[model samples]
Target: MSSPVKVYVYDLSKGLAGQVSLQLTGKQIDGVWHTSVVAFGKEIFYGPGICETEPGRSHHGSPLRIVDMGETHMDEQTFVEYLSQIKEHYTADKYHLLDFNCNSFTNDCLGFLTGGSLPPYIKDLPSDFLSTPFGAALRPTIDAMFRGRASTGVLTPPPDISATADSSNPASASSLLQAVAAGATSNNSEMPSSSRNYLPTPAPTSPPTPVQSNSLTTPVHIATNPSSFHNVLHTHRAVVAFFTSATCGPCRMIEPVFEDLAKSKSRANDVAFVKIDLGVGMSNAVGGEYGVRVTPTFILFLDGNKTHEMKGINAPELRTQVDLLLYQAFPPHRHTTLSLPAIEAIPLNAILSSQVPNLDIVLAKVTGFIDAAPSWSGSTTKEATKQILAKNIIPYLKARGSSSPPNTSFEPWKDATISLVTNLSAGELFPVADMWRVALLEPAVCSWSATKFGPGSPILVLLSKAEGAPRNYSLTFLRMISNAFANKIVARELLLSSRSSITALMVAALFHDDATVRLAAANLAFNMTMHLQRLRVEKVRGNVEGDDVGENEEWDIEMTSALLEVIEREKANEEIVHRLTASLALSIRLSPSIEQLASLLEVLQAQKILKDKLERGGCGDTGVVKKEARKLIEEVAEKLCS
Candidate 1:
């Protein structure tokens, strides 16, 4: 470009760097010169005199002069305003300031300002003067935005760039309206459609030409709220947020709880359960940003940022975490794979109330699809729909609930089925602790038995262990309850002891012909060693503490004595088949003075599975260990007395 007209002026920093500052300060040349002046749009330039090069600079660092659109000197007010804008807004991580090097922007900005050129490494730059050392103008905003943060750190407030551009630049509206009305200018005649209405007419005297500014981008903010959030985390001192959603069943289940919590003066005051509408705030862009595939994601926020995010509603467990969180003044909301808490690692109650963590947030996922199939021959689409209907979990549940089958019929997955039947005897299922724990601790059920007579899918849902049970009857038999919630049994009470109240339950648990029922009972026997040891310890402990050692109480010492007395009392013809219990009693007596654990170990050593079981229990490997121990302890105690 030819050297326009040489003009000297003070460099003013404003508008995206030195951008538009010159336009604001410069006066337009009217009449003949209007096209020339406005053609460059309204120019804004700021920076220093680069007429002199530093130690070793090239053409990119060529010397530059100054100019004021109307005068030879800058106005003090304009100068100050320009300085303030850049200090507050200008930022770039590439500008990390080093001790040896200058500040993040200084050296390069000065190079651009004086050279009237860019640094060889710099790409198309923002207002060149924004970084200039002219008055350290951008410092204040820079400090405020960064504020004691790491040099590489960045978290900026929402921008107003787009808004400002729409208001000030006429081209923004004209282009938008034109695009909106493309191929159909038919509507423009009706409405002026004014984006230009926001801006004050910038001195009508200026001509039709537009100013060029590829460097500046007005600040802008995203327009919508979020939909489903996987883990919208946050922290707070008090009840800071609420998590509610449009489709949460448990969120529905516990709506009463949240309301109750809200009503309780202390708890309500302590914390608030916020509702999050995942359905409304969902879109592919934001959905993918935060893993929010499920409804009713509760995200706790203390101030403005996130503290905790959860989906679904398990009242008991949520109460546990929220209660603790309030006491400790921390965030305890957690994410889980499903709505259910990890029944194994954590309390089953909490997982139930916890939100379901889903990263896939598409409607297609919720209403899953199947490929066109030959079996679905009728109008293929309708057939697919029928297939899906048949496969739905809801219908299966409804069908199971309608008949109300006997516990014996569902004995294969008895542990889980009982839990579901008991906990959710009503319409819904809330895996509460008392119920959830027992289901997990129950032994393996018979898979074949369940498959044959069990309400397959429905039983599986209520009794998570049902699927893990063995379904063998003829020759093949399987046993391994590897499912999650099977530990609740050990965590709760049982019906095996001579309490007449559980006699019916024992009959059902033991004699049921279904293989699932039998397998579950066998599974219960795995806790044999621990039961026997605990009984022995209780006997010794009661002797030392002089505590009430009643026959009815469920403890090691008491149960052992009771079992033996019962054996002698009944004097039945049946003989015990599982005999290691006798050997264990002798081992314990041979060394009563030894550590209580030593006696237990001797009995365990007598059986390989028992030893392996004890080893596993020591490492916290399985729920069966406790049950196994309980059984073994009882057996040994009975044998000693015999």
Candidate 2:
């Protein structure tokens, strides 16, 4: 059952009704009114007043009306706390006439307590009256007179029970209402003789219990002997042992509270609450073991190790300690629910159509070193730059050997394009990394992948005219860039800061129908995942990025999903198996949900891709993929599930 609410309305301007009509409203009116909320059984009255200490004194001598704003979910303590918050914010010094007056206060309390607002006729009265021209004209006089009175006398309420009532534990509703009525009928000119002497002793209480372990409902294990005590300690991960004596008065008072808490369903499985009465023939040696020098002592254990001990008849503290220990033993799993930004594709066609430089001449000049360039090697700056601009790089073919440039020529821009990409991969130039990504990379890849190869553009010329060689080179180029990002923090930072567009491009390529393209994209995705995993772990260890580049763990989940999608689609592609396995293995750090875990395991098992390779002791490369896959399988089985 819930407590009921009431609204007390008072006509503050009744005495000056005639003076207000002649000065402002220009017509006879009932009276100016104020309202307050009193929740039945809550033992508190909430009202707003100018420069006032408590409720009754501000609305003194005013005609009163009470309105019922039915049942509330708040209890007596919660209700009192709610009033404390209101009083803290609506102190007399901060009171206002037009903006935040008493009526506004009542409305706030009513809305919270009952989910309903005061009647419009009463709530809108001040604002509607102030909007009138005559009322507006008299605003200064009204403000001056009211504020002067509020600061001097109107805001000064006499000593009410609220002043004496405990802010944490309010007086009973019957007592508060009696105070309200007494304050209302008494003369406002003088303080009541008995008002200051009405302080009531608050009932003893405690804060609400923290969430307990559900297994608390099970019968407590009795440690009648040393062997039984040892067994119980070894069995339970967290044990709350109560050391009480039969003759201790405080222990008697708290025994029921302890028993009731032990019977609650919220207690954890590995945590136990037990009472051992030393007066009931328990040995002194047992008490000495726990260092129990006084009656009503508690000792907590974690994995048979003594962790914390408490003395006295404090049930709340005991329950609190148990909750803390349980939390440490089995912390709640917290996976973020925030959504990742959608991966947007780059517009390649639009970029190609715009100002394209003559790359034919540029490529010719740069390719002069092709013969002298060493074979494509590692990520060394000299080798990578040398290979990218080598002369063997296919030139953008002109129309039918007509030696005429097309209307839209990206072929002439190939040298400059390769140069920019190479520099980006080498971690040389990347101003506004996200801008370069959103503006250049995303649109270019999206447009190029969607369009067919043709003479109209340089890159398209290779994709269309050349056989498998051109496509292979393009895929390899993309893979190299991905690898660079995987190895270099600078490159990774730029790509990630680019609003995940770079990731989007890689994900898009992963779905390519061509096996070579898919393999390259898979490698890139694997590298990106590894890089992100490192950054995430570093962050958890308190390594802050100097640039304050915010990390969104949700993006990792999104990328993981994309990778999983690829795995499911291309499970039979052995060429990508090693990369996919390694990627999935490292990605396990993201803490995927149970449903995701089920899907991932089902895919691995049904395909027999990971299990078979691990059993045969053969996984491509240094057996890293196999090792990671085995580890991931075990981890998923252990942590993500039961």
Candidate 3:
């Protein structure tokens, strides 16, 4: 059943404020009241500037008027999730008094909720007020107060893992630990609380070994000495150490508590849990660092800094303090979260890897026919175009494969040859079998690379020349080949068999200054990368494998690095973001080393690509691309941290 959604609007300037506004601008205007969506009696509000969304609170006081937007097919939870996405993109930082403000937020919500926007008068009020000379002079004061109120009225909620990219709440240490612990051992089953009642197990005679817990929980490392504890702290981004003496009765009471905390939900946060024995005979140096002088002491370190410490016999207090400290250390933000869906790997079958029968003869016949054509005759040219388009030549090419097509011999028939390749690519079912055969004969033609084809590839050669029909045609032909890569079989052949040289050439083309060319290249790159990534994912899952499938199937870093370089070099290029997003996503999936991931993040941060996601007003495919890219980046960061 459809649910009722209402937009509650409050007019702050309805009284004296409206009078003042009228006197200043010769127009009667009410001060702005915050807007929120209410469903099932619960109000959903977003604070001014880019802030996290919370239920049951409004930065702006009570609404003066509530307008019903009618029924929505979406349920309450789904609707709120949608609002969260909007909040991630439409940040408070981008709020402008005359442009984007609270009213804009309301309008967007209304549009999404009811397929309509607020009244035009209300939506245009701020801009209209700013247009007058008197209002223009007062703009500075108005904007300052507006921004101040937005900032001051915001009420930050406790850390929620679902917080959007702009969440600023500081999570408690325990929360952070729980998050980290959850992330680390998510694959394993949880160890029962009853099983954790035992005393600390003595260290082995040899070096410390990882304890294989039956439950899926973060590993609890035992530090025999202070130095070992220090090493554990250095290894994890967040660490919680349980310092206890074996003889202490209170330490025994809370031993199970520490173990339970370690096994808390989601083991993906990557936090480390350590147990250090500070018994009578143990080293005191580590305890001295944390100033731990009491038995059953707990110290929390975030990013190598001692953030919190507590000592007590009460298990609740111990659990509370740890939770507060860990949350503060790793305040979870949705912006950096990544969703990596496992793609089942596909094993190579005979049709995919086996050589096409008689392809060499077919390629030889097509090249020979093109080479024998008389370029000087218009009638001959017309006939050649007809034959090429009619599929008369395709049969021979499919029937017999050639070692090498006469690339140079077809200098006079360049246009006709390009047309033939373009037409073949445009077919409904991409003739992967024939296309692969043709690609093997002229690898350069597969990527439409000018350098490899030289004068023989007329379209590509003309692309580097002055802007004219040639450049346009070059983009057209490139688009066709790129489209061919969208086909599963074709993509597999290029990525696995030909070894990705074609993919590299396509990526290199993104460096071009032309917006159209760059967009086409990006689209092409998106298709190829997605196809290759899917195959890679399948390989990872053991769902797909072939004779040539390498054991370690990683993303093409050369292509990825090239894409990153392009993203870095072309930060200002409006058309490059989509392509950059795809390339970076593909690179992230390829599982680059830690250093490589860090480098990619640094470039993204420096270029403000991730930061720019907070800005409003991306439309159509560009918006969709940005959204996907943002998700991929979050996943990349998550994987790197994990």
Candidate 4:
């Protein structure tokens, strides 16, 4: 007989997916809404319908599954209906394990059941599936209670089956016997479908042969044979748990992707990765205790217990949740513009709005992308970025556009724009490459100058808000840049952007010019006197038309050293300075090896020169003009000394 279909299922906590379930939000119905198909070894499969979930009975990591017959043409719509019936008739006690994507499998069953005549697409399901019109036949209805569609409490918490069989009914035992028989018989052709018949003891004459209770007793933890349950991380450490089902079609497709994601996120030392499977049957009762009802759920455990849960998520969401969870748990030991959300948001745009210009430009591009991007891949979180853009940014822009209080222009730049086109001039917007001749040289165009260094203690103030507001999309792009740099991909991409050293640097200069970076860099330079690489003071004496250009500019070693000393010593906060300085040191150490070494050599030489100047004029009767200078020098000297 064909093996009894085993599936993993979880009882969702209302706090996570349950809350999402309540919101009933997502683009699932416009076709491929929360659903998309993936190939199983080249054959398409979709799965783990929500109705198939067994509430209260299922654990946190249940493996509700798909009966993996190779690709079938069953429409996701028909598939949705068929599983609802399966969930009702077979219910919890009938199978070895419940499939999370059971409905999809059921639709697939009809493909086989009706001699492979299932409709190829949901739109072809005929009008009847929508609501029972004259030609509208009733399609399979899901447990609509969660969706607020209608109360199809067909598979709700059966108080008896949940917590000991409701004892009020004396015939409950006999009834359960009959149900079990039907469930077992229905599962296999070889076994008499009704083999386990309702055989009640002879009128309660003697103690009955202890019949196992009809109620599904959820074990504390049940794991598949290859699966294991682990606390993995103690309260003192970070924890990441991978939730999965063995038979699920979508889960199978995403497993490799997940493995890649987890590998990138996990560190064997501080962060822990534990894999949970509901398919392990009675082996992993511990997972059952947590109510894992879905396939491929990722639970972010902080300080030993689940602080956040990511269910029906894909590699990207998994990556995001891990990042945010890790950051919150461990408090990253570095200053960064790349916060958790930004990390997810940035790469998200990089992948989605890839052709768009700057982050601000992409804000408009966000709407166009959402309108055309297609919906979520069936039962996976991969397309979550598209979904999120639709939910958050797209709607926001739509509202702004409709209000039309201003901004009527269609041009990319329609306003009286004053951009600090300077940073883009030297194309320092590109990379750290040096000494490459380029005809791309336009006169230096400086856009921004600090607002007189700010009255509130040396804060940077971008002068022209003329183009609109200063973009704060930094959070999104920050993570992307962080990942790009972390992977050395930015450098590699710069090289590949063009074999021309200039082009790569041009790209780097613009891309890294985001304000978050400057602030992050400034913060890194905070409170600490670390070596500044590339510290040459160019001498320029010229008219606006470039006369007197013969002036020879020399690198003023001691004065530059003094400026460097002031920059480090003037850190507003001691602790911040200490941290930023240490981070600054680390960043330089991580810079491209050869060029940075030369920069370091120059800094060291400059430091020596400055030290000599201080030592040579020690406590001399320097003029009143030099007294203030003496004080500054002594302060810098004391800092260097200590």
Models, CA RMSD each: 29.1, 24.0, 27.5, 23.1
Model 4 has a clash total of 66
> Candidate 1's residue-wise lDDT over 222-260, tens digit each?
111231121112211354234444445666776666645
Per-model tally of clashing residue pairs: 85, 16, 57, 66
lDDT of 2 by residue, 541-604 (tens): 3222211224465664576567656754664455575566456544554343435654655654
Give the alpha-carbon lDDT of every model.
0.28, 0.44, 0.46, 0.29
Better of 1 and 4 by lDDT: 4
Best by lDDT: 3
- Decide which is better by lDDT, 3 or 4: 3
Model 4 regions more than 4 Å off: 1-405, 409-642
Q: Which stretches of candidate 2 lie over 4 Å from their true place?
A: 1-508, 511-520, 527-576, 589-592, 603-607, 612-642
* lDDT, residue 51, model 4: 23
Worst 10 residues of 4 by lDDT: 439-448
Candidate 1, overall lDDT? Answer: 0.28
Candidate 1 vs candidate 2, TM-score winner: 2
Query: For model 2, how many clashes?
Result: 16
TM-score of each: 0.18, 0.28, 0.30, 0.24
Task: Give one digit per residue, the lDDT tens place, for model 4 in 402-511.
Answer: 43423222111111011111111212112111000010010010000111112211011111111122233222222222222221112222222312332222122223
lDDT winner between candidates 2 and 4: 2
lDDT of 3 by residue, 1-642 (tens): 787877776543334334343323333455444455666556643322322222323433456677777876767666556554444334433333343444544544554555554454454344344433444454454345335434642212212322311112113212432322232111111322222211122211211111110011123544534434555565567788888776788888888888667644113223566776664223355677767788888887878888877777777886787667656654432222444542112112211122344544544544554455444343335456645433433443443445653333232335554544443322211232233334333333333322223343533322233123244443554465564554443444445434454555566567667777777677666666566555454433322121112322234446555665565455444446645554556545544243565575565552354334323432232332445555544444345323
Candidate order by decreasing TM-score: 3, 2, 4, 1
